[model samples]
Target: METQALDFPKIHAVLRTNGTGEVTINGTSHPIQADDEAAVLREALRLITDTAAHLGRPVKVTTTDPDGQGLIVVSPEGHVSEAAPAKTAPRRQKAPAAAPLITSVPEAVPAPAEQPAATVAAPVQTTPTPAHEPDEAKQPVTFASSVDQSQSPPTAAPEQSTRRSLKETSFLVSAPVLEPAAHGWRGILTKLGFRMEPSAEELTEREDIRTVSQHWPGPRTVAVVNRKGGANKTPTVVMLSAILARYSGAATVAWDNNESQGTLGWRTEQGGHNNSVLDLIDSSQTLLSPSTNAAEIARFVHHQTSDKFDVLRSDENEEGDHEVTAEEVDIAHQVLTRYYRLIVMDSGNTARSANWRQMIHHTNQLVVPVTAIEDRAEAARLTLQTLESRGGHDAELARNAVVIVSESTDSKRSMSGDALKRAKAEAQRIADGFAPHVRAVVRIPYDPALVNGPIRYEALQPATQRAWLAAAAAVAKGF
Candidate 1:
């Protein structure tokens, strides 16, 4: 395996003593649980063969267990075998020197009279010139000619001659780099003093983390828009803000930008004060004051302890008739921008509202969230169409929007066999519909954690978390 490079997609597995392990095929990870190491490997092998069957070929896997790490090749037919040992290449033997041709020797010339050795001053030591610098005074020396005692030796070339180009010269070159592995069996081997590189999955995960953790020059806003109820806009806002804050360590807040009663407050934890967007609007003047500190803004926004983000609710009073106007939206936005580096806004169902247009005006990135249901998908399409028809920054946002297609909440519980398959196919169909019209479209599997209550990142399944991370990375690229 060391002597040859395999072009097949690789699998990485690590089994722990607590009957828990992870198996990553290609770049997607799947969790495995069993009673012992044998069961773990059995499950891992099943996963490997399933992936191989899907790809219609074989795959190479590197596994780590309590004993140690090993490599194997598994085929779609369920055959598993140890990888071949490394073989050293054969050394080449040197050919014998050919005998010199027998020919008459030329007559030697008579030597000239040797003159007294001239007193040559010690060579002057000069500082070494850098590679980028042209050494004009230095000339090439030849032993064939006698020393010049009367004048300086000739220079290598005339001043008008072209100097060596920096592009052609190599300077301060380092040895080849070895990317250290920090995941799975390869990482274990590295910890044991062997050098290895990370797998493709680990590299991709690192890149996604890096993308979400980036800091732009100014405060940026993302508006999750879909002018339909139960479109998953609030969950999208919460998850995106959570991922951004958790990875970037930045001040991120998810604001409910609804004109009327919004469910964001119901879905998120409440802070000490039940201050809403209406309260913030009233205090915008004070919050915008230069003398106000950041801690004061915390009173209006609810803090999520585990998710590491803040949630700014809309007017949660059911009896309240006051709706946020465009002016109030600007007021709240200005104050929030002063305190938060990233703001993710959750919008209401009415796209024609003044507050909705105001939120769109402040958005730097647009995300459209939709469930797999037909009505939700149609609503998302109509929402984008409305924005594109405006023909300005709104159109630009619509063109660059990231669409998230989520599986229906009831599909997991009510569907099975062909019904579940049809549900997934429908989700994919919806995702495909948006793929051509938007910058990116991500399909999220149904996760019960996001169905009800405050959505926590730790409660999501591994696949759901990976999907959201990818979605967040896609949104970050817009910034």
Candidate 2:
């Protein structure tokens, strides 16, 4: 038997934005740089293959990137394949049958020349081999043409009964069934008894759904930020919250973290009462009390019936002179976090405000939304730069931010032919500019539903909904 002890050291690689990352093997770290994440993975695989060649064994590698985690095995001969998870349960081997002991032996007798005496042969006795025995003894034995058909075969010994120990049997058993396809031609065929697999597009959609429908260890906060008005921050927050809540079935809230008079309430469905974040603060003492029921806190936040998410709007009283202070932000956040598992915040156009900075400190994921207009894009860039300059948790959030570039809504109505083509090109160009700086960049097409009126998940165009789902999945990956 070939030796199973020839194992190579495992490699761990992390791919960051702009194709720069680090790979660790056998406790030693190596720098890896390339043009993008795909290129970085290729470079890391090459390094792993080289290590395998040097050690004359196949190397296993684990990777973490924007695409998520993966495990692969790389061989010196340039062969690569996904590595299956290692088993943890102890293995059971079938015990060999014990040989019968002989009591007495008879002397051999010569056969007569006239007629061959019917030869009586005793059963062949076998000895058990020790662990230290040669490898040849361990080789499996085969009997075929050597056996005489006329002679009766020896009675085989019964296999020693082997039963799994109670501990070896797992009480936690998972379903061993496959999910049938439910979309495209595969669905039709499956219903007709063909059992066809899902198409690539259906598979991709399922993956995106699975990605968004995940819950992390604790409550996660995503900040949709841009320090410039009309950058589509509110729309981004609404769509992210809607997608997350609809798919994950978790308590999600879109909080207007603006300082004053935010438009989130105007663009979303309202509850029975005209309550806002300020109202929530006024009732925080009761909401945070041990006797407070989960549903009791819903009085201050409006619920979007179709989107399956709640909205915590900013104070919209034009006659009142008030701003959300940093301390007020903390109080509101504490109350909301107690009731919601996910918080998608819409920011005001002031990055330097105490409330805005306080929101940043609690953010788990940063999303920058910008229209195709040059000023909006510039403002988004400046916001990320400001965070990066802070040099701590803020900088880390900036480096791992997700930038979403949305096409200008007015362009679709006013532009056409060459003008419309140029508009789309501009949006793509803006999205590309942020690809190197942030963890991911997603481009959203202009949709009429997002231009004005109350925003609802069902009101958006199908393409617009898909784009938002992809964006939400990308944000979920950060958690």
Off by over 4 Å in 2: 1-178, 411-417
- Tell me the tens digit of each residue's lDDT in model 1 across 19-115: 5676754444557777643456556656666655544445666655433355655555555545532112222132124423223222222222121
Scored by CA lDDT, what does every candidate get?
0.75, 0.74
Native-referenced Cα lDDT, model 1: 0.75
What would the TM-scores of all predictions be? 0.64, 0.65
Using lDDT as the measure, which candidate wins?
A: 1
Estimate the overall C-alpha local distance difference test score of candidate 2: 0.74
| Candidate 1 positional error at 374, Å | 1.2
TM-score, cand. 2 vs. native: 0.65
Candidate number of the best TM-score: 2
